[model samples]
Target: MKSDSTVLPDVFRICFEHYNTAKNLPTGKIKNPNEILREFDFEIKKNPADAAELFKDMQLYLKLTPNTLTPNFQNQLFSGLNQYALAGDWLTSVTNTTMATFEVSPMGTLVEKKLIEHMNRLVGWENGDGTMATGGSNANMISLLVARNKMFPEIKKEGQLNKRLIIFVSEDAHYSFEKAANILGIGLDQVKKIKTNPNGEMEPSHLEEMARVSLSEGEYPFFVAATAGTTVLGSFDPIDRIHEISKKFNLWLHVDGAWGGSVLLSSRHRHHLKGIENVDSMTWDTHKMIGTGLMSSFFLTKHNGILRSSHNHGGEDYIFHESEIAEWDSGPSSLQCGRRSDALKVWLTWRSLGDLGIEIQIDNLFTMAIKAKEMILEYKELELMYEPSSLNICFRYRSVSDVNTLNKKIRHRLLEEGNFFINIATRKKETFFRLIIVHPDLNETHLYKLFSDIIRLGNKIKEETEFCMVKT
Candidate 1:
């Protein structure tokens, strides 16, 4: 709060305090929009406020926000942040450097390059190219852009040709593929959603049939996105079989491994992504499975210079100078001009926990998922929506009437209670809870408690609903 060299240290103290508090907090206290507006002063003023006032505001903000760092939190793809990752992120912020060029970010550049090299080798690529993206969605978009430009180079400048370029993705694939298509001028209609099996894995035969039909209809099939971990079901499409289909059609194979790519480190679970070496490009987010901080996403490609060729454009005459080190600059190969050093946190985290450490973390999550499934099966009131494939275990408390509505209400009540925070998703018109075994500290006790809460709350909601109906 005071002006001087000590201000930063004071802020760090507050941060550490908040971090300690967050780790121990039971699920976050959920605040509605109206309550948040009344509870905090969010308006920005033209005049500079006292440092003490601003510090108080910062504390209040942290207090009101959801505690995603806590072990009880399992609402999203990512969970607790790694300590080394936090340290690196703080260092990166204090340094305040951009990652466009090596000259500006010498250590950052080398760190990113080395991290990419290490990750590429893990994915079975000997000399692949990669770049750190803003998020997993951006990584997927970059993959799509690179694939498109490689397949149709002229489209980069000359725009769309006579043919309607088509892309294929499993029905379970992330929606980012469709968003990428729209951004690239490839119509959303051209993005065909190939049907998946009952287990949510994409069917290669269906993809082949669809590609054949598209070709017969005079459409160009250029790309196929195979998901390594689907959003709702955590299903990994059979990469070996899908690779065969991609080869037959001459389509660029992009594996969207944003959620499950960390499995590559696990010898036991790595079989989920078999034939990953054959993929033209991939998206992997260490923040999700590896517990690096938020938004540590990478877009990797087997093609050497395709990314630079696809995204590069001549600009910034003042900034672009002929120099020996210019070639090492990562600016030309990315979608953003002024990129933050997202690689530093991941690099630090990876260094803190070597490849084996990463493997153990991922392997533990997979084992926890299996344990969760077994616990669900043991409960008669709970229904396992789908077979366990990865860390994502979908299930719900069963009710005789209006099960979908009941599950939705149960989730709402769960959040309102603020003892546990989880997520729910619907498939085939059936709503169910998507319990992710993502947190490093989540265990059988937490799973047992979650199931108990769901059943207890579900019965209460059903009884209230029936009582109201009878009164009406």
Candidate 2:
């Protein structure tokens, strides 16, 4: 690795410009790809391509990047970046080592193990094991894979064996659960969806009913993926009740806490995930809740060393060399041969904040959600969709007619206006907005502006549509 001056400087300036332009979102000008990139492919063909010229081209790319940092950038679950985590990311890139090998990513592997140990303790697991994954979905998938393997080890070698193996998840569970089921060769149909209540929490009775049906229908119901925090509604399925059913049915209980798992740090609110300690496995995404850099997700299991039994693959020689007490290489426990040092970012973020810092942050976010709910309820024009179980407040503005269509148009107008961005969701065949309070910078003013802007837009849209309807 020759210290390439041009490439290094180019990448740095590019990143700087990216951080700058990400917030300057376009109001109406969005050129099509045909006119924007203009070419099908691009590469670093030559050396010293003039820093000034390179910087200009990079700025254009930066302008297109999503401004995940802004208070108005509420398009997804994770809305901001942690400064500490971002610094760790820079160090990670500088080290540039694959996480699979101990000799290369020794520190990275140890950091992840430490993080897992800390997280397991947070979950109240006395003896547990875990591994960092590419994303929450991948982590969730691995959870299913490991649970399946642990429940039916013979299937690993014998392969499904036409037993019609099935897994269960709430209808409100993330789509990743189904995707994981598909990848494990269980087929999409084998992923049964349990019904949920109006608030979006999975009904425990529904889970038991589904399990009975599956068993009677001659299908093996071996797993139940519960959601600690569903993406759209932020609902928590009754984990304690679900755990009881799982224990009674001999099911491998896995909780998808990628979105809401951070509550483990909030001692005041950790009870929201009651009995999570009893679950067989769980997926937690620090990146989503803690604002760690991307891909900081972990799949943890209470069964000691089950990941090795589940995901251990590839070479039986050379790499898995002899060591006194096991070398602790991450490759054997992962789905990928070469994982990144994603753990360091998460580790640094957690270490910097400590459990107390995280608790405060989590508490703050929850308070913000409560504030948002109160503000929404105060507005006669605003309708509280479902009582927020966690940090996501699902609601939309109330209007005279075409409530769903009006809400959708107001959302579209709000996005096009570019002052703010709140995501719209459809639940039970009704349209509404889901305001996420995950970003640390969001405060009362932010919530007030969001509600005020929404009402303003709703009124404008209602007037326009009503006049149009009258004319028609």
Candidate 3:
């Protein structure tokens, strides 16, 4: 057995070693459940394990897990870790306090309040209110709940009655909206999907037409969500145009900017979210683009105190005490009672980078996106699927036949090889590679190598298929 003082230092040393060598590690190694179970000792016993045994287990865990910190990782929207944010996360764990009450977590409560204030300013809101959510999905759900409660105040206490409530979102909006609809007691079928343009942006005219039809059919259209940076093509819905329809139909307008909200940091690219201030509420995920740790999501609204009005109930007699700073308590506004302190990491990251540094990082990513598009164009075999509106670049290799199948195979091979980690998306029944350029270390050299490998793998697969057919 080792003392706590000695154990802490030894564990930290192991963590440091793993962190320093993460870049050299393979992005991931494919393994099935059976394979992993066979390889690792993941059993519990009545007896306590030795400290040395636990240390070895920790090392094994790090070795087997995918290294998202490396440049080779581009499989998801988020990649790479901010050192300051990491430090903040460590500190948050060391403190181990709940954000339920201001008294217990005074600094944390203030940090969240200040971060929301800064984000509100970016969105052009003067007297706005917000709360850190579990994730973007949670934030989006909160938006729906608040909108529903505001429009039909009776529903909160009296329950959803005979009224057939409806909500509208672009066809390309994240599926989380539908999930939110389900969770918020709004039936899934009641969620309407407005048609989008060829570029994947919401068609404002179509939105108006649908609202009119819904009104004529005696359905109450209460919410219209405009997507800022859709999931697949990364398209920004015309917020200004959509706002007109929302106002005309008396609908609560919410922008699901979970994927692209960070663009507000960049002066040159902030135009993507034009007219954002007019929206009633928004969902922003700092973890996606800002590289903060996971779950740094905010559900912000221009309407002051709406969050508390919607979510606060039955907590005053207990956790929420009567004090001057009781108004600053975050539990009353949040959906969860025992909320983890998620604000510190985002605050630390933002402070370390400052607004200018963040803006430069965003601008540089856009530049990298353009470079990726150009590089794809230069390749004779590669075909661009859609002109990228943001950081997500969709393209695929050309095959004489079964192009979609070939592209899927190439992606699988890339994953199996563990040389490059990327993703593929299917739209309109056509599958293609969806290269997310998010990691700061991702550059021209990495792009060139990825393309070369993709082309090589595509050609190899095609040749193998032809040979098999000839043999048959």
Q: Compared with the true structure, what per-residue lDDT tens digits does model 3 show for residues 1-472?
A: 4455566788788888877877656687766789889879999988888877887888888877878887778888888888888888899899999999988898898999999999999999999999999888888899999999999998999989889999999899988889998888789999999999899999999889988999999999999999998889999999998988888999999999998999999989999999999999999999888889787899999999999999889877777888898888888888998887889999999999999999988898899999999999999989999999999999999977888899999999998898788999999999999888888767898899899999999989999999999999
Per-candidate TM vs. native?
A: 0.98, 0.93, 0.98
* Candidate 2: C-alpha RMSD after superposition: 2.7
The digit string of per-residue lDDT tens for model 2 on 171-264 reads 9899998888777898999888899998899999989998998889998889999999999999998999999999999999999999999999
Models ranked on TM-score: 3, 1, 2
Residue pairs in clash, model 1: none
Per-residue lDDT over 1-472 for candidate 1, one digit per residue giving the tens place of the 0 to 100 score: 2366755677899888877777767777688999999989888888877877877887888778888888789999988889899999998988988888888888899999999999999999999999999888999999878888888888889988787999999989999988888987898999999999998999999999999999999999999999999999999999999999999999999999999999999999899999999989999999999989887999999888888899989755966567999888889888887888888999999999999998898888888999999999999999999997898999998888889999999999989989889999989999999988898878888888889999999989988988999999
Indicate the worst ten consecutive residues by lDDT in candidate 2. 22-31
Report the Cα lDDT for residue 65, model 3: 80
lDDT for model 2: 0.83
